[model samples]
Target: MRKVSTWEVLFVPLFFLLILYPILAILGNITLEGMVRTFNDPIFWDAVKNTLVTAFFAALLSVLMALGFAYFYIFHPGTIIYRIADFMNDLPIALPHTVAGLALLLAFGRNMFGFAGPTGLAFTLLAVVLAMFFVSYPLAARTIASSAEEIDREMISVARTLGDSPPQAYRRVVIPLLGEAIFSGFVLGFSRSISEFAAVIMFGGNVPGMTQVLASYVFTKVEEGEVSMAVTASAFCILISLLLVLFLRLEGKLHARSEKSA
Candidate 1:
């Protein structure tokens, strides 16, 4: 028989309560009135719509880019081309979002090739999506690549031997095996894009009714001393993010169980 210390049980819950009580206290204090007003606010809907749009497209683009890089890395691991692609995918992780934003702004801003196109990507919703993609693609790529590593090369070889072309093998074998990882990557990318601050602000210019996302809206509200509104918005964001992360984790677990059963 093992003996337990009296402090262990009390200490664990107490530690968590100490950390979580303040947040719950704040949430409790925020009224439904603030939430209702936040929803009714014109800027709120704009930020919500823009944030969803940006997150969706950025996630889609990041998933595609990650899929491509993952495929190359997995199937062509011995090639110098694959090595270079891996390096490029990994580069963004170390690169600060601000530096990336600055580089993007310089490339697309009015001073340079701004003459090349009448409406450059600079300061547009498109810029927001692209910037989000740039910052998020690496996370997706790494996730997908790790999943790809777990797939059986022998299965792919057998499929190829059975007259499946490369593309066919990928569709039938790789895609099925990678569904969880790809889904995980998309979720991660969307989460990153939604929570992002500096990159989108700098690259997309935080223009209200144009490029302003939820995070920027929160920032604008806080800067303008709209304390209640800002707190409401921040709380809403926190709730949504927590729900999403929980959903993604549940989905991942279910998928893993299904895979195991099969």
Candidate 2:
């Protein structure tokens, strides 16, 4: 065994503390009373329900879109459509949340689509889900595309040659190889949607029993000077994010184990 240098021992801890200590400290300060109060609050329950529902639907939609986009990119890498899709996928990451919200609002707001048309979508729960899906789909699609690029197209072609239909070849040959990455993308999209704030608030309009989510609710509480309530909600978001991250990590480990056994 060699003696560890002071710098080596301190480096990792310093980075973690710098990045995470404030959040941990804030969470630590929330009393059991604050937690219990939040739990019993109807608003809290409503927010929780809306958050979960939006995240679930948004993740599902995002993953589906990601799958289609990734497939197109993989199979038609040189096409103008693929190039355009790649450029659009890079937009969400580069865009400011408020700017994205405004752009979405402008496109979907009432009278823009048509007065008395399907414009109810602009300031409703559906808008929240749509915003979340758009924000997260690019992330999922990019991850899937990157993984798809690494796979051997020859195996898929061989499956096609051996009487496998396109769908069957994809299911048997491609999906299994890309399963871990796909699952990772799904979790990432879900987690990202759950924590969305500015876009969700702008698009969903914070209708308490309808569209209010954890982040927006927390912001509302903070604005009203309900510090404890805001802190409690923030803590809840942190907890959910941590849980999702743990699940994704466990999933990665399981996928690695399965691959090793194979």
Q: How close is candidate 1 to the true structure, as a TM-score?
A: 0.87
lDDT of each: 0.86, 0.85
**Candidate RMSDs in order:** 3.1, 2.3
Clashing pairs in 1: none
Q: Give the poorly placed runs of model 1, Cα more than 4 Å off.
A: 1-29, 111-119
Cα lDDT tens digits, model 1, 88-201, are 887777888888888888877766757756546788888899889988998999999998988889999999999998878888899888988899999999998898878899
Candidate 2 runs further than 4 Å off:
1-16, 115-119, 163-168
Give residue 77's lDDT in candidate 2 (0 to 100). Answer: 72
Would you list the clashing residue pairs of candidate 2?
none
What are the models' TM-scores? 0.87, 0.91
RMSD to the native, candidate 1? 3.1
Residue lDDT tens for model 2, 78-103: 99888899899999989998888878
